[model samples]
Target: MQAQSLSYYEILHLPPPPHTTPTISEIRKAYHSALLEHHPDKSILTANDSSTPTVDEIVEAYNILSTSSLKVLYDQQLESVQQSKKIEEARFKRLIAQADSIDLDDFQTATSCVQHSKDIFAESSSITLSTGYARESCHGYPEDTCNLQQIWFRNCRCGKDDAYLVTESMLEHAFLESDNAQSDDRQILVQCSRCSTWIRVLFSLAE
Candidate 1:
Protein backbone atom coordinates (compact mmCIF):
# COMPACT_ATOMS: atom_id res chain seq x y z
CA MET A 1 0.00 0.00 0.00
CA GLN A 2 1.05 3.56 -0.62
CA ALA A 3 2.59 5.22 2.43
CA GLN A 4 0.23 8.12 2.01
CA SER A 5 -2.92 6.03 2.16
CA LEU A 6 -2.87 5.70 5.91
CA SER A 7 -0.43 6.82 8.54
CA TYR A 8 0.12 3.90 10.86
CA TYR A 9 -1.66 5.82 13.57
CA GLU A 10 -4.56 6.69 11.27
CA ILE A 11 -5.14 3.06 10.28
CA LEU A 12 -5.76 2.23 13.90
CA HIS A 13 -7.62 5.51 14.46
CA LEU A 14 -5.00 6.42 17.07
CA PRO A 15 -3.25 9.62 17.71
CA PRO A 16 0.52 9.94 17.47
CA PRO A 17 2.12 9.13 20.81
CA PRO A 18 3.56 12.10 22.70
CA HIS A 19 7.08 10.84 22.15
CA THR A 20 6.49 10.09 18.46
CA THR A 21 5.88 6.41 18.88
CA PRO A 22 3.25 4.21 20.45
CA THR A 23 3.99 1.77 23.28
CA ILE A 24 4.14 -1.94 22.47
CA SER A 25 0.99 -2.62 24.51
CA GLU A 26 -0.92 0.17 22.77
CA ILE A 27 0.09 -1.12 19.37
CA ARG A 28 -1.00 -4.62 20.25
CA LYS A 29 -4.36 -3.49 21.61
CA ALA A 30 -5.20 -1.41 18.56
CA TYR A 31 -4.06 -4.12 16.16
CA HIS A 32 -6.12 -6.76 17.87
CA SER A 33 -9.27 -4.61 17.95
CA ALA A 34 -8.85 -3.58 14.34
CA LEU A 35 -8.41 -7.17 13.24
CA LEU A 36 -11.44 -8.35 15.17
CA GLU A 37 -13.71 -5.62 13.79
CA HIS A 38 -12.58 -5.86 10.16
CA HIS A 39 -11.93 -9.59 9.90
CA PRO A 40 -13.16 -10.57 6.39
CA ASP A 41 -15.00 -13.78 7.36
CA LYS A 42 -16.76 -12.26 10.39
CA SER A 43 -17.67 -8.82 8.99
CA ILE A 44 -21.19 -8.82 7.51
CA LEU A 45 -20.26 -6.60 4.59
CA THR A 46 -17.31 -8.72 3.60
CA ALA A 47 -19.36 -11.91 4.00
CA ASN A 48 -21.82 -10.51 1.41
CA ASP A 49 -19.03 -10.11 -1.19
CA SER A 50 -18.24 -6.52 -0.23
CA SER A 51 -14.71 -5.04 -0.19
CA THR A 52 -13.15 -2.82 2.40
CA PRO A 53 -9.84 -2.39 4.19
CA THR A 54 -9.21 -6.01 4.97
CA VAL A 55 -7.75 -7.20 8.29
CA ASP A 56 -4.47 -7.80 6.47
CA GLU A 57 -4.43 -4.16 5.44
CA ILE A 58 -4.70 -3.19 9.09
CA VAL A 59 -1.94 -5.66 9.88
CA GLU A 60 0.26 -4.09 7.24
CA ALA A 61 -0.08 -0.73 9.00
CA TYR A 62 0.40 -2.37 12.39
CA ASN A 63 3.57 -4.16 11.37
CA ILE A 64 5.17 -0.97 10.17
CA LEU A 65 4.40 0.93 13.37
CA SER A 66 5.06 -1.99 15.72
CA THR A 67 8.56 -2.69 14.39
CA SER A 68 11.21 -0.41 15.93
CA SER A 69 13.32 0.32 12.81
CA LEU A 70 10.32 0.68 10.51
CA LYS A 71 8.64 2.99 13.02
CA VAL A 72 11.71 5.21 13.05
CA LEU A 73 11.72 5.47 9.26
CA TYR A 74 8.00 6.13 9.18
CA ASP A 75 8.34 8.83 11.80
CA GLN A 76 11.03 10.54 9.74
CA GLN A 77 8.93 10.39 6.61
CA LEU A 78 5.96 11.78 8.48
CA GLU A 79 8.03 14.60 9.94
CA SER A 80 9.33 15.55 6.51
CA VAL A 81 5.82 15.60 5.09
CA GLN A 82 4.57 17.73 7.95
CA GLN A 83 7.50 20.11 7.64
CA SER A 84 6.95 20.55 3.92
CA LYS A 85 3.28 21.31 4.51
CA LYS A 86 4.18 23.93 7.11
CA ILE A 87 6.70 25.62 4.83
CA GLU A 88 4.19 25.76 2.01
CA GLU A 89 1.58 27.28 4.28
CA ALA A 90 4.06 29.85 5.55
CA ARG A 91 5.03 30.81 1.99
CA PHE A 92 1.39 31.27 1.02
CA LYS A 93 0.74 33.44 4.06
CA ARG A 94 3.79 35.56 3.22
CA LEU A 95 2.59 36.09 -0.33
CA ILE A 96 -0.84 37.05 0.91
CA ALA A 97 0.57 39.47 3.46
CA GLN A 98 2.58 41.20 0.72
CA ALA A 99 -0.41 41.53 -1.61
CA ASP A 100 -0.66 45.30 -1.05
CA SER A 101 -4.08 45.05 0.56
CA ILE A 102 -5.26 43.37 -2.62
CA ASP A 103 -7.33 40.23 -2.47
CA LEU A 104 -5.43 37.07 -3.36
CA ASP A 105 -8.57 35.59 -4.97
CA ASP A 106 -8.68 38.49 -7.42
CA PHE A 107 -6.92 36.92 -10.34
CA GLN A 108 -7.94 39.77 -12.63
CA THR A 109 -5.92 42.51 -10.90
CA ALA A 110 -3.22 40.06 -9.82
CA THR A 111 -0.93 41.24 -12.59
CA SER A 112 -1.33 44.89 -11.53
CA CYS A 113 -0.94 44.29 -7.81
CA VAL A 114 2.57 44.76 -6.48
CA GLN A 115 3.28 43.10 -3.17
CA HIS A 116 6.50 44.02 -1.41
CA SER A 117 7.95 41.79 1.26
CA LYS A 118 10.32 44.13 2.97
CA ASP A 119 13.48 42.60 4.32
CA ILE A 120 15.45 44.80 6.70
CA PHE A 121 18.65 42.99 5.82
CA ALA A 122 18.15 43.66 2.13
CA GLU A 123 17.50 47.37 2.63
CA SER A 124 20.51 49.60 2.07
CA SER A 125 21.54 51.61 5.12
CA SER A 126 23.12 54.40 3.10
CA ILE A 127 23.49 55.61 -0.47
CA THR A 128 26.28 53.54 -1.98
CA LEU A 129 25.79 54.31 -5.71
CA SER A 130 27.10 57.66 -6.85
CA THR A 131 24.59 60.27 -7.98
CA GLY A 132 23.90 61.44 -11.57
CA TYR A 133 23.42 57.91 -12.88
CA ALA A 134 21.80 58.02 -16.35
CA ARG A 135 18.70 55.97 -17.05
CA GLU A 136 17.20 55.14 -20.44
CA SER A 137 13.98 53.48 -19.22
CA CYS A 138 11.49 54.51 -16.59
CA HIS A 139 9.37 51.94 -14.78
CA GLY A 140 5.96 53.34 -15.78
CA TYR A 141 7.12 54.67 -19.12
CA PRO A 142 7.97 52.70 -22.25
CA GLU A 143 11.39 51.21 -22.81
CA ASP A 144 14.28 53.57 -23.74
CA THR A 145 12.08 56.53 -22.91
CA CYS A 146 13.41 57.69 -19.53
CA ASN A 147 16.35 59.79 -20.75
CA LEU A 148 16.63 61.84 -17.57
CA GLN A 149 20.14 61.65 -16.15
CA GLN A 150 21.86 63.18 -13.14
CA ILE A 151 19.78 61.77 -10.26
CA TRP A 152 20.30 64.16 -7.32
CA PHE A 153 19.73 63.69 -3.58
CA ARG A 154 18.29 65.68 -0.63
CA ASN A 155 18.23 65.52 3.21
CA CYS A 156 16.03 62.46 3.83
CA ARG A 157 14.01 62.31 0.58
CA CYS A 158 15.02 62.27 -3.11
CA GLY A 159 13.97 64.31 -6.16
CA LYS A 160 10.62 64.28 -7.98
CA ASP A 161 10.66 67.62 -9.71
CA ASP A 162 9.11 68.49 -13.09
CA ALA A 163 12.25 68.04 -15.22
CA TYR A 164 13.94 65.12 -13.42
CA LEU A 165 13.52 63.29 -10.15
CA VAL A 166 16.53 62.36 -8.05
CA THR A 167 16.52 58.74 -7.11
CA GLU A 168 17.49 57.69 -3.57
CA SER A 169 20.47 55.89 -5.19
CA MET A 170 19.36 52.92 -3.06
CA LEU A 171 15.87 52.35 -4.47
CA GLU A 172 15.99 48.93 -6.02
CA HIS A 173 13.32 46.99 -7.90
CA ALA A 174 11.11 49.95 -8.58
CA PHE A 175 9.10 48.09 -11.19
CA LEU A 176 9.12 44.47 -10.07
CA GLU A 177 5.61 43.13 -9.44
CA SER A 178 6.55 39.99 -7.58
CA ASP A 179 9.65 38.61 -5.88
CA ASN A 180 9.12 35.29 -7.60
CA ALA A 181 9.03 36.88 -11.02
CA GLN A 182 11.54 36.15 -13.77
CA SER A 183 13.33 39.51 -13.96
CA ASP A 184 15.24 41.39 -11.28
CA ASP A 185 13.72 44.84 -10.84
CA ARG A 186 16.51 45.82 -8.46
CA GLN A 187 18.27 48.67 -10.17
CA ILE A 188 19.83 52.02 -9.38
CA LEU A 189 17.21 54.45 -10.69
CA VAL A 190 14.61 55.09 -13.38
CA GLN A 191 12.80 58.19 -14.68
CA CYS A 192 10.29 58.99 -17.36
CA SER A 193 11.56 60.96 -20.30
CA ARG A 194 8.05 62.25 -21.03
CA CYS A 195 6.71 63.15 -17.57
CA SER A 196 10.12 63.42 -15.86
CA THR A 197 8.72 61.25 -13.12
CA TRP A 198 11.12 59.06 -11.13
CA ILE A 199 10.05 55.50 -10.49
CA ARG A 200 10.40 54.81 -6.78
CA VAL A 201 8.21 51.97 -5.55
CA LEU A 202 8.48 51.73 -1.81
CA PHE A 203 5.79 49.71 -0.14
CA SER A 204 4.24 50.75 3.15
CA LEU A 205 5.78 47.81 4.92
CA ALA A 206 9.26 48.83 3.84
CA GLU A 207 8.72 52.36 5.03
Candidate 2:
Protein backbone atom coordinates (compact mmCIF):
# COMPACT_ATOMS: atom_id res chain seq x y z
CA MET A 1 0.00 0.00 0.00
CA GLN A 2 2.95 2.34 0.45
CA ALA A 3 5.28 3.66 -2.28
CA GLN A 4 8.91 2.53 -2.24
CA SER A 5 11.88 4.80 -2.85
CA LEU A 6 13.96 4.52 -6.02
CA SER A 7 16.85 6.50 -7.50
CA TYR A 8 16.50 7.86 -11.02
CA TYR A 9 19.18 5.56 -12.43
CA GLU A 10 17.82 2.58 -10.44
CA ILE A 11 14.31 3.24 -11.77
CA LEU A 12 15.62 3.11 -15.31
CA HIS A 13 18.26 0.45 -14.56
CA LEU A 14 20.89 2.64 -16.29
CA PRO A 15 24.45 3.64 -15.43
CA PRO A 16 24.82 7.17 -14.05
CA PRO A 17 26.32 9.48 -16.69
CA PRO A 18 29.48 11.47 -15.76
CA HIS A 19 28.91 15.04 -14.48
CA THR A 20 25.41 15.29 -15.96
CA THR A 21 21.77 15.66 -14.91
CA PRO A 22 19.21 14.34 -17.34
CA THR A 23 16.67 16.85 -18.76
CA ILE A 24 12.91 16.22 -18.49
CA SER A 25 12.79 15.12 -22.15
CA GLU A 26 15.72 12.72 -21.63
CA ILE A 27 14.07 11.34 -18.51
CA ARG A 28 10.81 10.77 -20.43
CA LYS A 29 12.63 9.06 -23.23
CA ALA A 30 14.47 6.76 -20.83
CA TYR A 31 11.18 5.90 -19.02
CA HIS A 32 9.36 4.98 -22.24
CA SER A 33 12.30 3.01 -23.53
CA ALA A 34 12.57 1.02 -20.32
CA LEU A 35 8.82 0.39 -20.31
CA LEU A 36 8.81 -0.79 -23.93
CA GLU A 37 11.72 -3.11 -23.25
CA HIS A 38 10.56 -4.70 -19.98
CA HIS A 39 6.83 -4.06 -19.50
CA PRO A 40 4.89 -7.31 -18.99
CA ASP A 41 2.35 -6.53 -21.78
CA LYS A 42 5.16 -5.88 -24.29
CA SER A 43 7.18 -8.92 -23.25
CA ILE A 44 4.29 -11.42 -23.06
CA LEU A 45 5.09 -12.78 -26.56
CA THR A 46 8.88 -12.59 -26.18
CA ALA A 47 10.90 -15.79 -25.77
CA ASN A 48 13.15 -14.12 -23.15
CA ASP A 49 10.36 -13.52 -20.62
CA SER A 50 12.71 -14.12 -17.72
CA SER A 51 14.60 -10.91 -18.52
CA THR A 52 11.50 -8.67 -18.47
CA PRO A 53 10.09 -6.85 -15.43
CA THR A 54 6.37 -6.48 -14.61
CA VAL A 55 4.22 -3.58 -15.92
CA ASP A 56 3.41 -2.50 -12.35
CA GLU A 57 7.11 -2.35 -11.44
CA ILE A 58 7.98 -0.27 -14.49
CA VAL A 59 5.05 2.10 -13.86
CA GLU A 60 5.93 2.47 -10.18
CA ALA A 61 9.56 3.35 -11.00
CA TYR A 62 8.53 5.94 -13.59
CA ASN A 63 5.80 7.38 -11.40
CA ILE A 64 8.27 8.26 -8.65
CA LEU A 65 11.22 9.78 -10.57
CA SER A 66 8.97 11.64 -13.06
CA THR A 67 7.17 13.67 -10.35
CA SER A 68 8.90 16.83 -9.08
CA SER A 69 8.02 16.35 -5.41
CA LEU A 70 9.02 12.70 -5.41
CA LYS A 71 12.24 13.45 -7.25
CA VAL A 72 13.13 16.17 -4.74
CA LEU A 73 12.47 13.79 -1.87
CA TYR A 74 14.65 11.15 -3.46
CA ASP A 75 17.47 13.65 -3.93
CA GLN A 76 17.16 14.73 -0.32
CA GLN A 77 17.33 11.11 0.75
CA LEU A 78 20.52 10.67 -1.24
CA GLU A 79 22.00 13.72 0.46
CA SER A 80 21.10 12.32 3.87
CA VAL A 81 22.80 9.04 3.00
CA GLN A 82 25.97 10.93 2.03
CA GLN A 83 25.94 12.82 5.36
CA SER A 84 24.93 9.88 7.57
CA LYS A 85 28.49 8.92 8.51
CA LYS A 86 29.15 12.37 10.01
CA ILE A 87 25.80 12.34 11.84
CA GLU A 88 26.46 8.89 13.28
CA GLU A 89 29.94 9.95 14.49
CA ALA A 90 28.46 12.90 16.39
CA ARG A 91 25.71 10.74 17.89
CA PHE A 92 28.21 8.12 18.99
CA LYS A 93 30.28 10.72 20.86
CA ARG A 94 27.17 12.12 22.66
CA LEU A 95 26.06 8.62 23.62
CA ILE A 96 29.44 7.75 25.08
CA ALA A 97 29.37 10.87 27.27
CA GLN A 98 25.84 10.07 28.42
CA ALA A 99 26.76 6.46 29.12
CA ASP A 100 29.70 7.58 31.27
CA SER A 101 27.51 9.82 33.49
CA ILE A 102 24.33 7.71 33.74
CA ASP A 103 24.04 5.42 36.73
CA LEU A 104 21.59 2.83 38.08
CA ASP A 105 20.96 4.97 41.19
CA ASP A 106 19.72 7.88 39.10
CA PHE A 107 17.34 5.58 37.24
CA GLN A 108 16.02 4.20 40.54
CA THR A 109 15.46 7.71 41.88
CA ALA A 110 13.43 8.71 38.86
CA THR A 111 11.34 5.54 39.11
CA SER A 112 10.68 6.17 42.81
CA CYS A 113 9.59 9.74 42.17
CA VAL A 114 7.17 8.59 39.47
CA GLN A 115 5.73 5.93 41.81
CA HIS A 116 5.28 8.44 44.64
CA SER A 117 3.41 10.80 42.33
CA LYS A 118 1.15 7.95 41.20
CA ASP A 119 0.41 7.00 44.82
CA ILE A 120 -0.55 10.58 45.70
CA PHE A 121 -2.84 10.66 42.64
CA ALA A 122 -4.49 7.33 43.56
CA GLU A 123 -5.63 8.67 46.98
CA SER A 124 -8.53 10.68 45.55
CA SER A 125 -9.04 9.10 42.13
CA SER A 126 -12.74 10.04 42.08
CA ILE A 127 -15.34 11.95 44.19
CA THR A 128 -19.11 12.40 44.16
CA LEU A 129 -21.32 15.34 45.32
CA SER A 130 -25.11 15.57 45.55
CA THR A 131 -27.66 17.90 47.21
CA GLY A 132 -31.36 17.96 48.02
CA TYR A 133 -33.81 19.93 50.20
CA ALA A 134 -36.83 19.41 52.49
CA ARG A 135 -39.21 21.77 54.28
CA GLU A 136 -40.44 21.84 57.90
CA SER A 137 -42.55 24.19 60.03
CA CYS A 138 -42.91 24.85 63.77
CA HIS A 139 -45.97 26.07 65.66
CA GLY A 140 -46.12 29.87 65.45
CA TYR A 141 -48.62 32.76 65.33
CA PRO A 142 -50.39 31.15 62.37
CA GLU A 143 -50.72 27.85 64.18
CA ASP A 144 -53.69 26.44 62.23
CA THR A 145 -52.02 26.76 58.77
CA CYS A 146 -49.03 24.86 57.38
CA ASN A 147 -46.41 27.02 55.61
CA LEU A 148 -43.96 26.12 52.84
CA GLN A 149 -41.14 27.85 54.77
CA GLN A 150 -37.93 25.78 54.57
CA ILE A 151 -34.25 25.87 55.52
CA TRP A 152 -31.56 24.87 53.01
CA PHE A 153 -27.87 24.04 52.98
CA ARG A 154 -25.54 21.54 51.26
CA ASN A 155 -26.00 18.23 53.15
CA CYS A 156 -27.91 17.55 56.39
CA ARG A 157 -25.98 19.07 59.35
CA CYS A 158 -28.67 18.93 61.95
CA GLY A 159 -28.96 20.44 65.49
CA LYS A 160 -27.18 23.69 64.62
CA ASP A 161 -30.28 25.63 63.51
CA ASP A 162 -27.90 27.60 61.26
CA ALA A 163 -29.51 26.63 57.95
CA TYR A 164 -30.53 29.63 55.77
CA LEU A 165 -33.97 29.93 54.20
CA VAL A 166 -34.00 29.15 50.47
CA THR A 167 -34.50 32.06 48.04
CA GLU A 168 -34.01 32.57 44.30
CA SER A 169 -30.63 34.18 44.98
CA MET A 170 -29.64 31.46 47.44
CA LEU A 171 -30.59 28.74 44.97
CA GLU A 172 -28.41 30.38 42.35
CA HIS A 173 -25.53 30.51 44.84
CA ALA A 174 -25.91 26.80 45.60
CA PHE A 175 -25.87 25.93 41.88
CA LEU A 176 -22.73 27.98 41.41
CA GLU A 177 -21.10 26.34 44.41
CA SER A 178 -21.66 22.85 42.94
CA ASP A 179 -20.46 23.94 39.52
CA ASN A 180 -17.29 25.55 40.88
CA ALA A 181 -16.48 22.58 43.10
CA GLN A 182 -17.21 19.90 40.46
CA SER A 183 -13.61 19.88 39.22
CA ASP A 184 -12.07 18.69 42.53
CA ASP A 185 -11.75 15.08 43.68
CA ARG A 186 -13.42 15.76 47.01
CA GLN A 187 -17.02 15.02 47.96
CA ILE A 188 -18.82 17.85 49.79
CA LEU A 189 -22.54 17.48 50.68
CA VAL A 190 -24.50 20.37 52.15
CA GLN A 191 -28.08 20.48 53.39
CA CYS A 192 -30.36 21.85 56.08
CA SER A 193 -29.45 20.07 59.30
CA ARG A 194 -32.88 20.50 60.87
CA CYS A 195 -34.91 19.92 57.67
CA SER A 196 -32.79 16.90 56.60
CA THR A 197 -32.32 18.44 53.10
CA TRP A 198 -28.97 18.21 51.42
CA ILE A 199 -26.81 18.92 48.33
CA ARG A 200 -23.88 16.89 47.10
CA VAL A 201 -20.70 18.47 45.77
CA LEU A 202 -18.24 16.43 43.69
CA PHE A 203 -14.66 17.43 42.89
CA SER A 204 -11.48 15.73 41.69
CA LEU A 205 -7.80 16.35 42.12
CA ALA A 206 -5.79 17.77 39.24
CA GLU A 207 -3.91 15.29 37.09
Highest TM-score against the true fold, candidate: 1
Report the lDDT tens digits of candidate 2 across residue range 104-197.
1221111112112223324434311111111111212243433232222221245433242233333345445665563543333444435534
Predicted candidate 1 versus true structure: per-residue lDDT over 159-194, tens digit per residue: 322222233222333434345345443322334334
Which window of ten consecutive residues has the lowest lDDT sum in model 2?
103-112
Kindly give the number of clashing pairs for every candidate.
Answer: 2, 24
Error of 2 at 127 (Å): 59
Query: Candidate 1: which stretches are off by over 4 Å?
Result: 2-4, 17-20, 45-52, 99-207
What are the Cα lDDT values of the candidates?
A: 0.48, 0.45
Worst 10 residues of 1 by lDDT: 108-117
**Model 2: lDDT to the true structure:** 0.45
Best by lDDT: 1
